[model samples]
Target: MRKSVMTGVGVITAVVFTGGGFAAYNLWNGVTGGTRAAAAQPSTVATPAAKASAIKAPSAEAAAAGAKAFLAAWAKGDFEEAGRLTDRPEAAVAALTAFRTALTPTALTLTPTAERPQAGAPMTFRAEVGLPGAVRVWRYESAVAMVKTGDGGVVVHWDPTVVHPRLGAGKALAIRPVSSSVPSQVVDRKGRPVGAFPSIAAVLDQIEFADDGAQPAGDGTGVVVVGSAGGSGGSEPLFTISASKGAKRQLTLDADLQRVAEAVVKEQSGPASVVAVEPSTGHVLAFANNPAVGQNRAFGGATAPGSTMKVVTAAALLETGLTPDSPVPCPKNTNAGGRLVPNDFTDARLGYTFKDDFAQSCNTAFIEAAQLRLKAGSLPAVAKDVFGLGLVWKTGLSAFDTDIPVETNPEQIALAYVGQGRIRTNALAMASVSATVQSGTFRQPVLVPGKAQPMAARTLSATVLNQLRSMMQRTAQSGTAAKALGSISGAAAKTGTAEVGGQNPNSWITAYRGDLAVAVEVQAGGHGADAAAPAAAKLLQLGNSH
Candidate 1:
């Protein structure tokens, strides 16, 4: 009996030890290889198909509950909660934040409307936000769709406002009141008033903003008053002016030359504008419009400058100790920031001096000069501060803002050196540059003299200016600008043809003859010599005759 009891105890001991060993093995597996065990197991959870069939469609009450929770969270600044309620939690947080930032106490209120569940898809909810303090209440409607997740939670699949509203066509914001009074009289450098027709208010109404409820002044005499209709159905004049108080002076513009420029532009295309500025005093002598009178693009239209910007590049190079005699490699094509820089105008090319390159409008020559020879830093800043390429110059009568790309990348700088990329300037401003070069001092170009402040001071040295003048004269005498105004005595000019697709490209001729400096542009014209130079020559002759 004693022996039997010992045997039984031995067996029990073995069994206990084996059970403990098995438990220890499981604990070790759980710590080191839990992922493997989990992968090996066949999950009893339902598949996406099974879940779709098993889950009930969301009721209207549930959708409303979700929307209310979302809005409440949003109003309370609980972005996380709001996101949790919407399909796009991250986007929901961002949208709610943007709405909060934009909508002040004066802003509108948002209210949710209908809720519907798609048969096999997610549930959708709708809402509207109304603008209150505005003259007109602008309403923005939004919709959101929610879907069930595998984790028994809901996720938004479609936030229509977040996705579609940005893509949808919508009207621009209501027009605001004009800030300042329209200039009535444009006076000359001699203090003589320009010819009076109508105030800018009247002209803008006739041209661009008539339906905005601008009213002409009563009494039908000298000045015109612009008024807006008040809420009480009465016209409240926003501005008042006297027309006959200023002297009626005439511009130096030749009607015949202006018509010829218009004809050239029309022959090329409908979308074109021309500006002629006197380089001596920066007076805008002739401004012409193509596509008739309604399409006014002379001062406002912004197009890529192309190679015309090389003038600034040349100026920069000259300022940085590079003379016209500087030697630069005339590569057929060179890589600039991974882009191939090539000479576009001519096929027959050779080594060129800086002067020859500029007169002939060589792209690669300037690029090489700007990068390797000049070694000038910050071309865009120089263009802005020196050449005033992207400045908003107000001519007292009207104003246009220049658009230049503020990119600092190598590609942008390389392209900008050749007047490609996003460099843009109006004809008036371009004329100012020519005037600056001619006068040996930068003068703010103005339609009405003394109306604008005088230009600060001379930006370039007289020696550099003379060098540029000489090169420009050579350009007129034998280079690309030779055909147009070359034979005209005492004319120093530079012509540029900027490539714009499908059109003839923009042509420019800026020159100075004796005392008058002029700048002219022909949009979509074949070449500066063929199109813009003739107009410039005629205007120069007219100015000289006067």
Candidate 2:
């Protein structure tokens, strides 16, 4: 036996009893209808069975009403009420939640194309979406299916396609960064094309493609609407909305110096980078990388600075009443923080002056001094308070600021004093370090003119600056950097060789002449003087000529 139930009030056509079962027919002429069961006389037992059926289906007007309520609730952001109007409440709720969360639309509007009843199960509407960095609204046609329920009412059929026609099951909407159209060209300080210099092309690409809108004529970055099953990366872009602000953008780079830097790094045997800064104004004169295709290592590299960190260490000691000529001990190797530390130089002197240790790049002398006289917070404090090492930089480009975390371990602190453990910097930041020592002030470096710069907390004291300059000058004149610096007059420098376990050490050199300060690095280069110093000297020479 089969039984059927009909909803709403309706006209009853007939009722009959057969084979110990009953059948009823519901007939309607467009009004509401319901089914009723009544006992009937057994007159047709063992005869053909009759089936119950409804004569009328829901009208198009009714489906439109149901869709109106659901869409109204959704437009008001009342997702729960909207879900209740759908056939699958749970699925509808989840999809709606995901739609709002993923797109992050600043404004959303859904308007039905026609208010009049439509002769279709799926109702169509215009979906307009707005985003934060987008220049225009994204508009498209979307639809939902209206279905009749067992309760004799209509409901919206829940499906991912209801949210977006192209949206598939288990997929989501997302916004991603696209290259902008405005500021179409990047130029140097003198308005020459920056793309010509392959050495700094990666950096120029980042700035040109950055998603910023601060400049009135710079439209920053473009945005795209994508339907993705995974993260933003590898997503399929469905629509692109481009923005426009300016025609061209200029940087603070000097063309001649940039060419010199590019040429110098090209001659290195391994990966190398050079960054030059103007000491007085904190302008980045030039920055270059040997293989300029991948990462912009000149500004974003995070590696141990080796003995170049002695500049900060020496400053911290100078704050403690130690002068340049103060007598200090330089041992071949000494136990520091439970580890035997040694200097690059083999000769051990009992009364080497502080100047001698700095000029000779003595690791043991610095380790011993820090172990006895300094605390864990001493170096970080001096780095932040004086030279602006760990501050947020707004250089109008992608850059990795120097990171020197405060350490409590004696071993780590000892290593940090000589710039080995837990200390990381880039060529750009090291150049800024030398610039600060040259000018006695920490002027934040800038690539794009008029970008806001972070204020340096304090300037190096006159006494400390003078002594550091004297020691660095001695380094260039008669110490490790002597041959590399050659005849560069009025120059100061410090050389570094950072060990990386099984790999050859990274060679480093930071130096300044007149108003120009430069830093050079050669990855897997054996010694600072042999590799990095020559490049630094060449860049400093070209930079000073400007």
Candidate 3:
């Protein structure tokens, strides 16, 4: 207060001096706040805690819907649809299509259980497909594993089961007896045991009996004696039959001829089936698939008859008053349902008499004579009744259902006359036709040899039969089949080439020597002459020699 009075404040100086510098101290404190008090206030903005993302669990309904759609698509052979439902769509389509093509199911039932949801994961389902009486089911299962993919779906991964582990490594499980009563032994025509009748325990080494246990008989438990002895400790009665137990009798099949035929078939056919059957007796002499054993093209293979079926048309026409000598005008091309039917294989127009047409395998001639000229409506029935083209014979072997797809239209009939329409037959059925003509009656083709039984007697008139035979003879001598039967004496043959979808044709030749009727087929090969006829010639030579 002593010096401040005059410095800067005149009025404040008196108050400041009186207050003993209290005002001045207060102002100084406000300007520079205390650091300690400010630091004591709690932090208003807090640091965020570690965040965790919430995962979604798949719904059972969605998973089930996917599984159902997958199965339906699989059944319909729609691979693409099936794929979309799977986690790995591309892989699923490929695997499913392969399964569909490989497995032929008599019955298929798929039952998918409730979806089992994994913890914080996608849902999954279980399905069981029952394949009863499967030959290689175990192998199939081993090669394939049920797996759920990352996206949430199921698939089968191949894992084949190990074959016979203990008794025989390579061999499959031996047939076993389910009951102790001893099932009747299977015997061949010669009274030989067709195969080993070892007790299931004997072949398999260890077998569990059914709950009923063994049946009681005169001596000990009534187990029918199997193998070399009856349980009675006596030598098993050897029936006077020349057959022995557990022995496979060598068939009459000529192994050398079979090799040649198989080789030729492999060389010529592209994914084709070849079957050589004894037509008169229906004995399947040689059944071979082009690729090898399992392709199943011979009896099961089905294809359009093409012009080769004209042989049946010719026969049908002859049955209905038209003969090889019947004067039927063969135009270069006959109009059929807006499409022109040309004369001969070249699709060229030519004038052919009935015989010329038959020898040349003329489509226009046969069509004009069979469908247009003759009783058109009667052709199918005539084919069924006379030639047996659509007839399903009881060969006691698995066969494709032969059909003459019902044709009510003129175009269809024309196509049928040339074997291009709905008409379909397997090698066995076609051979039966040839055999019927040769034997003057129809005999069921027999694969398991025993006694040949007649399914039906002669359905064609003797005159019709003779005329057909004569025409076939002419075919062998100078027709499309002439070269096939050229060197063979007493061999009457007809060669056929059936056209398929832009594929190499199916060749067929059926011939008979004395009691043996043979039908030879070459698929995806050349004409009947090059493919089927050569095989027939060789077979005829072998049969004649025997």
Deviation from native of the Cα of residue 154 in model 2, angstroms: 50
Residue 125's lDDT within candidate 3 is 25
At residue 355, candidate 3 shows an lDDT of: 76
- Native-referenced Cα lDDT, model 2: 0.72
Candidate 1 vs candidate 3, lDDT winner: 1
- What's model 3's overall lDDT? 0.49
Best candidate, TM-score-wise?
A: 2
> Ten consecutive residues with minimal summed lDDT in candidate 2?
2-11
In candidate 1, where is summed lDDT lowest over 10 consecutive residues? 3-12
TM-score of each: 0.56, 0.63, 0.57
* lDDT of candidate 2 over 1-546, digit per residue (tens): 111111000111122223322232222221112211111111111211111221233578777677767776666555556667776665665555555444445666666665634665567766666655654455677787777666576777777777767666545555554444335556677877765678654444356333444443333333333434244334444544443534566788888898889998899887888899998889888899878756788988899989999999999998888888888889899886798888877889878889999888999988888877888899999988888899988887778989998998888899999999889998999999999999999989998887776768887778778989999999999888888885889889999988766699999999999999999999998778989998888876665654
Alpha carbon lDDT of each predicted model: 0.52, 0.72, 0.49
> What are the RMSD figures for all models against the true structure?
24.3, 20.0, 28.7
Please name the candidate that would achieve the greatest lDDT relative to the true structure. Answer: 2
The TM-score of candidate 2 is 0.63
